[model samples]
Target chain A: MRKAFALIVVLVAIGSAVPVILHWWPMAPDISADGHLIDQQMASTMVEVGSAFLLAQFLLAYFVYRSADRGTHENIRSIPGGVKLAVFVAVAFVGAELLALGMQGQRAWAIQYFSTPDPNAMTIQAQAGQFAYYFRYPGLDGKLGATHPEKINEGDQNFFGLDLEKDVAARDDVVSAELAIPVNRQIRLLLHTKDVGHSFYVPELRVQQDFVPGLDLMVHFTATKVGKYEIVCTQLCGMGHHSMRAYLRVMPQAEFDDWLKQKASEQ
Target chain B: MRFKIACAATMALLVFPSGVWAGTITGKVKVDGPTPKRKVIDMSKEPACAKEYSPTDPPRMESTITGPNNALVDVVVYISAGANDEGVMPSQVVTIDQKGCRYIRHITAIHTNQKIKITNSDPAIHNVHPLAEANREWNQSQTPGAAPLDAKFAEAEFIPVKCNIHPWMHGYIAVLKTNHYSVTDGSGGFSLKDLPPGKYTVTAWHETLGTQTQQVIIGGANETKTISFTFKGKAY
Candidate 1:
């Protein structure tokens, strides 16, 4: 029974660790041009963390097996370093892992967040509400008209509430339910929330950004693939949070231009 | 003299059908007690709706609209029982419009299986989400100038419809089995005319205020009966 117990512990540890180490269930394909760095960071962290986890599990199983023979309290003795040494080792080991992981992650985070968007990059506005997302593109003038929150009438199909009659710039703005962008073209997306805090997450694009109410935040990315991906809200804003989703379509430049034109016609 | 009497009787039958149009019920719904001040809607978020009203006369919340004489607007008064028209479907398509981000008619009473046509007259996009417990709920999105959306409720229910995109916008769609229903106008007046002579369980429903029922009886003669309901006022 003692031998069986030890075997079970070891088996459980290996059985749980192997599948994750090999990444048998991988993530969706990365479609963003800069997502490679993020993927590298993620892979490195998983490997490093997985090795530590395996080490701890193996040590636990080995101790359990060793103690099985010497069951009495008479054989239980303090280690050479005592409890103090164990605490120090734990702190040092965990602290080093965190510092290393954070440093590695900074490379991936900085490249996407720290750099300035190119002047010619397309600018799109993304607005998050209780249960839906709407995207607006700057039309031919390459400029977005000023937005008035008071003018937002969803019944009128005016989500942004731009005064199109008075604002010529707003008349050409194209709003779409889906976020469509040209592949390989840098897109500067301005994020705003109409109500509560919400997050925009797309696994394939390796992008997850939150919209802080009353504040406008920007995210820039260039998609490498041309396909449709799901853009879901990770924030639990309200009862309809689960249904708060939109589509992210990375299209060819010509197709994207035509889509924008069609949306503009709708406006 | 006999021929003249026959002509007069025939004209009376033509003007008012014998069993169908026996009597009419007319009434007003009044709210009792101290009225709560309505919250002025901050149209700063909606310039189009706001531009129409001034700072001193801003748009107010439509949850409980009150008028002079303690009048309650937007209440749905219908015959719940003792009416012969139960399960009779209405063929007329009731039209509702979304203008200035508000439902043009706050309360709509339609018979079960009656078509309700919803149109977007605003410049922005609007979505219709009906939270119905007795019937299958549905959601639809409409753009400006898009075609009207028509829907039907298969069962009787008081479904609350809202624009998820605009949280403040809300209205009610009352689907009843009987065609004898009337929604109170601005003056809190409602008249269910051409009701056949019968005892009716008249129910008055308010969105914020609970429902009240009063028994009304109509004689076989072409007479008009009066009734009224008053809901206890409370601050929301």
Candidate 2:
């Protein structure tokens, strides 16, 4: 019976480790990019620490079971010293956990908020709508054409309609439906919204940003892979939000230039 | 500037530089078969969503048809021109609105990178969801009388738009890379405007009818043609 109990406890311990093992051995892409490597490492350490705690409990259970099985009439052994040590270790572990959490939180904050725009980065303006993302390039002006919040309408051929009547820079703005980027280059994205709030998320590149009206938020990332990827708006903007898809083509610099030239000729 | 505008207008009519060639593709996207009964927009799962507005009641969907030959409105029938040669806007914008918790127009044409407008006219808020695989999934809400929005497709995808708050609110935005396209009207009729004089493959797509492709040649003025698409199963 004692052996059976010990075996059962061992099986339970092993059973509990399955999820931790799978989590440590993830096959899919991490949405946090490489930032989550630390998190995964911490999680693995946490699993080991939890296994130690479980082992301690199992040891105590074994001792009790053995005493009962032997039918002894003596008093239980006192491990006050060991108990105090365990408590101390637990407190220290908690403190370490809190410290790690704080460090991770700060890193996330810096990545999300404190980073400044790169001066030589390729910039693209993105506007979120009911179910789509409208991308605008400054053409040769290096600036967006005038677009007033009220003057923009998809109807009447006034899309992103930045009241060219009012916003002069908008007069020569070139708008496109697709988004293209050059490989190995930092892409600075300026996010805006014409109607509702939407989230711009790309899973393969591990980048997500929000497009909010009245305020412009920026996000930057470099494409290491030269291929086509889906640029989806994760935010629920409206009835058509599910269909809000954009294409992100990461190509060699020369190909990207050729594409730009073709687009310019169309204008 | 006036001469330039007139020159542009004349060019538009000339059908050469404007690419407004001859031999146009015209037809109706009518429901030639049995149709489904019209039901009110479903708002059961979202209980508090009803409270955001005045009366806690869902609006009736007048877009639904209850006849044998009821045309599927808002069904985007467009030409898949192919991936944009560049990031240019090769297609025109198709406007689809949300009025009284249901999608307006019922059908429209969609081309790659074509802009889409979603407007809300009702007093209550509605959550719009685009459950697309080729595109990213998204959900957004428009408040009562919110300003119209501008949406553009980044890739070629036939993405259907719906309302999460109101499940019955459904529509489609067909994204193709082609310029030869048209949306079927209430009578199931369609039109492909302004083609450069050339031999091109014309295609018609319905949200329910799958797609049909044909080859035609354009020479000069508006050339009218008729093409009909039939669905095998009953339309719900």
Candidate 3:
């Protein structure tokens, strides 16, 4: 019975680790300039945690299998070092592992959160509502107009509630349903929510941020590839949340200029 | 035999007339008691629509557009029972426009087989999501400069339509089986012309106020029955 139980435990451990080793469901390819750091951090954590899991399971199985059926006359055996020593070892190893992981993550974390965007980073405004995303671009003056929540009429398609009639800066602003940026150029995306909380997540870009209601947040990233990607809301806002998504289009610098010009004309 | 045949022929002509039904039901809907102050909509964040107002003249809520003398502007009156309408759904299309972030006709009724068109006249995108129980629920996004969307409901129901992107955009589309319906105008006076002389359960529906029903029996030729629905005022 002991041998059978040990064998089952071993089988379960191996069965779980096989998928990760074989990469059955791997992540989408990273297309952003800063994705390498995040990928490295993720891989290191997985390796450190995975090895711990496999070792713990194997140790448990080995102990079960090695346990003996002794007569009443035999003395119970204690572990080699005692509870205090065991506790010390656990604390030392686990503490070291945690410290190492945290220290390793600083590199990625600093780049994502601590550092400010570049001076030449193009600025864009993104608004997330119940079930959709609307993006705005600063036009000729390189300035985004102030927003009026009441004037955000969907019927007039005047989303973002820009006062075009009076606000000269807003008259030329370009709004689109998709996020388009020049490849390799830093993008400063200012995130705002119309109503409830929402999150902006893009798997390929390895970028995720949340939009708190009544608060504006910003994230910056540079896409290395000229391709189309999907931006989805990870936060559950309401009934239509599941369908909340927008597209990200990365194009050449000249093409982006032309695109922005066309979009501005459409405004 | 000759007299009996002549009487039967005259009765048949009255029952199945080649001309339109001459009976009419006309009346006014009044709201009783004190009226509620219109709730001012806060559009401070929406600068486009907010610029039109100031601290003393902010935009007011428009859920129920009431006229002078307590007349309900958007009430829909129709035949609810006891009338057999065998005519086909009208070939004319029913159009609803999205303008200034509001539905052009707040309350619209169309026949079961009739077509309803939704157009976006504003510069923003409007997501049309209809909350329907008896019929299939559908949502579609209409973008500026895009073609208008057209659809029809097979079953009879009163569906509340809203713009998901713009929470303030809301209206109702009453999918009805009868073609003899009248949506009350600004004066709260509605006239249902050509209602055949017979029995009918007349129903008046208000978006804010509840619905009311009255039974009318038209016994005379080309009868003109007058009826009125009085609803209590809502403060909120």
Chain A TM-score per model, please list them: 0.95, 0.69, 0.93
Tens-digit per-residue lDDT, B1-236, candidate 2: 54553454455555545453455666555555554333223232233333443533434343333223655544445444421222446555667877545577655456556778788866667777776787777877787778777777677777767665444456666666766566655565667766543444566665544666666544445656665555433522
| lDDT (Cα, tens digit) per residue for candidate 3, span A69-105 | 5444765578678989989999999999999999999
Q: Candidate 1 on B1-236: residue-level lDDT in tens?
A: 54553454445556765455647889999999765445444333334544666666655567678888889988999989866666677678999898877777877889999999999987767788998999998888887899999999999989889886555567889999888889888789998877665567899999878899998766555779999999998742
Q: How would you encode candidate 3's per-residue C-alpha lDDT over B1-236 as one tens digit per residue? A: 53553454356456775346677888988888655444444332223434645657544445567788888877889888744563457889999998766677878888886898899877666788888899999999887768999989888888888888655567889887787788888888998777655667889988767899998765554789999999887643
* Residue A9 miss distance in model 1 (angstroms): 2.0
Interface RMSD of 1: 12.2
Q: Which of candidates 2 and 3 is the stronger one according to DockQ?
A: 3
lDDT measured at residue A206 in model 2 versus the true structure, 0 to 100: 62
Please give the distance, in angstroms, between residue B109's alpha carbon in candidate 3 and its true position after superposition. Answer: 5.5
For DockQ, candidate 1 versus 2, the one ahead is 1
Off by over 4 Å in 1: A75-79, B1-160, B163-236
Which prediction has the highest DockQ against the true structure? Answer: 3
Using all chains and alpha carbons, the TM-scores for the candidates as numbered come to 0.60, 0.45, 0.60
DockQ of 3: 0.10
**For residues A28-68, what per-residue lDDT tens digits would candidate 2 score against the true structure?**
35433333644544565576567666777688667756765
Error of 1 at A141 (Å): 2.2
Model 1 has fnat of: 0.09
